[model samples]
Target: MADEEEPKTAFVDESAVPSAQASGEENGSLGNSWSEVSDMRQGLHQRHVQMISIAGTIGTGLFLGSGTSLARAGPVGALLGYTIIGAIVCNVVLAVGEMGALLPLSGGIVRYTETFVDPALSFAIGWNQVYSGCKSTFCDKSGKAATLIQWWITINNAVWIVVFGSVMTVSTLLFVRVYGEMEFFFATLKICLIIIVNVTALVVVCGGGPNGVATGFTYWRNPGPFVQYLGIEGALGRFLGFWTTFSNAAYAYAGSDSIVVAAAETRNPRQTIPHAAKRVFARVAIFYIITIFFVGLLVPSDNEQLLSASGTAASPFVIGANIARIPVLPSVINAIVITSAWSSGNAGMLNNSRYLFGMAKHGHAPKIFLRLNRFGVPYCAVLLITLFMSLAFMSLSKGAATVFTWLQSLVSIGALITWTTISVTYLRFYYGCKAQGIDRNELPWKSPFQPYAIWASLFFLVLIMLTSGYKVFLHDHWATESFISSYINIPIFLVLYLSYKFINRTNIIPLSEIPIRPLLEHAQRFPEPPEEPKQGWKKLNIFWN
Candidate 1:
């Protein structure tokens, strides 16, 4: 979030951008005025950012959380839910990617929200990210660490929580490149695992399993596609099922924004950010939609194991393997699932620290959080975030893990809110650019469909976010905790937004006053690198490369 403020001397003088700088000089200097907010090094290579995106996104929400979605929505509902949400996520990626590639700042989303929309909005979203990132890591680490550790013997999950927490904390404190490399390695592993699961699902569907049964769409036929919800019966119930699964889809796509956040630390972000953002749609299609499709084919939505309390049997891959009577595959898949959880926790730490650092850099948070170590790590923010990892210890208490699960539901809500904010920010940015007489074609990246895509996505996302737990409000379908976790963030977000606005009396930047000209000139000064030449097997590596 915050980094060592690069000296203003590093910036170009008035002689550099003579026209725009001189114009702004009368009001406020642009290039000389703005770049001082944050100064993180660009140590993340193209590979690092690509894999970081993969690692952040393809995590537990896909590996294990899909089970509940399958059970609640049935196969068709689950698939449609994820597909629709994935599309919305792609739109968000494009919006953020366009802005991020041009600006490429640390905490790009939060910073953009502040600059284009409202500072109060940015402040609320920034701290929401911090709190969401910190609180959610605990239950995630505790549960997954327990699963992996207990493979050997029955032991307290608290022990494993401490172990994994220390490892992640230490790893995060390492140099930025080291952290990038570590994530790249883990991300590749997760990618490989997803491929293996997809392949295995294909085999299982084709009767390659020990059962010698060609599963095909038998489960979908039997379950009859849409799942009825809350005994409401018929189409409305099915629709509710689909709507409920949106939150699960949200959880799966949580980390897509991490790419935008990491722009400051990314190499050739003007080129890399857009390139990576363009690839998001393909990755979601192949990695998530395809996997979910096969998952629907291989595992029945009604399978009791789909809701396993320990989260082991609930993994559709595990269910498929067991159904096929495949030897050792279940255990291996479970192991991979464990690692994915840890990877998510690690990714969260990295993203949230940057978010906090961004807040501090922008003066929305304490300056102490701006402290950076020799390696350019936000030491204070990292230390504080790590301290919150101890919240996982609460899982040791009876029923507390369940409570934690309910609380963790808020993570998906936070993600939806974050995405909505991004879309709104992008709309403001698009209009602001038009208002300033800037040509969209001159930008580093131009997202397709303009404000329409963002508006449609934002509207539906708000609809989903508001009704994510709609069933809890139904008659005799009530759970107080569920209702709270699902909708409480809405009012809380408003409170944060309004409180900040009321306190600061912050007004949205006028289109005429928005520093679009200097920002465009700044981008013009640094043209993106030429496209790299590719050949032979290297060209084929485009799937991951």
Candidate 2:
């Protein structure tokens, strides 16, 4: 299937018409009408988009994985790592916001890559996202399974995997609004939990808790705020620890890039997408950075329970709550962690299904994926992606479980590649605008910094991808699987991009040849809907809704 020939449809470089019309003119003879066929419903509101951007990212990565990072890198290392990655995330989100507002499509950046960059790039990134989403869902369920048994010791993890997987699949197959509402509620729960936990952590850090023992920065001073990596001594070791924590930070922010993927199903995307993208920085600052800071202050980095296999103990916040002697807060936090993990799986399902549907619409995937039901849900694509959710069952087997971990590692690389591609595509689009004498001010949205931000993000992303597994290359630290998991996707991405270019005889689209006019005209034709004033206390919805 990887080597399948590209469709020999005529390439219409002109953009006097909309993309759907132009595609019909060039590919009509090939029965390629799916691009014109609207299979998705714009059932999502501005509130749903905002919530999804927050909910998709604030999952096990921040809640559970942060514990491991603290234990490995110490308080200072973890803070620096998350702070750096958060800045990169801000840049990527800004770039995506500018592009998505101009061309708000179903698959967001995946579709943008096809139109603004290369179709071959789109193909590679699209499949990469789909695979990542599937693996993420599997991992979410596995983590949820582990957390579920913490509540009850008798049940097997396989049962929770099946149960959680089934629930997410059903929701994905439903109307898009159902999924949106589901995510909205889950995201609200997460936002509330973060606020509550952060405030409680502050209480513990100060002497407000029942224990009345002030523990302000005591852990940081005791642990000395830097862990030596692999028992290596010196600055190099601390640097390695920070670098390792940087990778863990990536996992915390994984699904963030896909925040705009559902734009095609959102109302007034020209307004909502850019608006939602702007909120990401605040969310990261409050929910991630502040929370991590307090978690470090409350929970010592050297505590063994930070790396515990048990769900409750592995949570730094839960452990801190226990130490503060907060009545019943530990159990409450544990339950929220389980729900957040399950929520991540649901978000993954939504992203994967839409990605497949977008690919099918553009002829990058099988035609079966183009099928949509009465509610405009891409049922076929949902079912196909949901099939992979069964992989969660592999956790029951010892040997297959090891393979599952490797697969998860491969998927982790996909986000880095996707972010790199986003910056690259934005650069191409930026240059294309300049060459064509287009006014950037006329665009619906514009990023703060231009080519510099794009280049810096690209350079850093590539550097991280190359060095993600640097430890494996150190003397006496070599491991075959670790080496492959870190570097394998680089070659795989190249193969996919090069092979598609070769098969299709695709060329680097010249700036003048790029189709920007029709897109701008289309966007202008659909001006954003005006906001209605809210009366009374309902106006507070503007804060988060």
lDDT of each: 0.78, 0.77
Q: What is the alpha-carbon lDDT for the whole of candidate 2?
A: 0.77
Highest TM-score: which candidate?
1
Highest lDDT model number: 1
Which residue pairs in model 2 clash with each other? none
lDDT of 2 by residue, 1-545 (tens): 11111121222223344442134523221123224224566778788888888665578888887987898888989998898888898899989999988877678677778777777888788888887778777755554445555564656777777778888888888777788888888888888889899898888788899899999989889986888878889998888888887677877888787767877677777788888888888878888888888888989888888876565577887888888999888777777777788788888888888888778767778878878776777889889887887777766565543564466467667778888889988998899999988898889988888878878988999899888889888999999997897778888888888997788666666777666766677567656667766778877774344
Per-prediction backbone clash count: 5, 0
List of clashing residue pairs for candidate 1: 1-354, 1-357, 1-358, 2-357, 2-358
| Model 1 per-residue lDDT tens digits across residues 428-523 | 889988898888998888988878899999999988887878877787889888888888888888999999889867777777666656667877
Q: Which segments of candidate 1 are over 4 A away from where they belong?
A: 1-39, 543-545
Displacement of residue 432 (Cα, Å) in model 2 is 1.0
User: TM-score of predicted model 2?
Assistant: 0.92
Candidate 2: count of backbone clashes, pairs at least 3 residues apart or interchain: 0
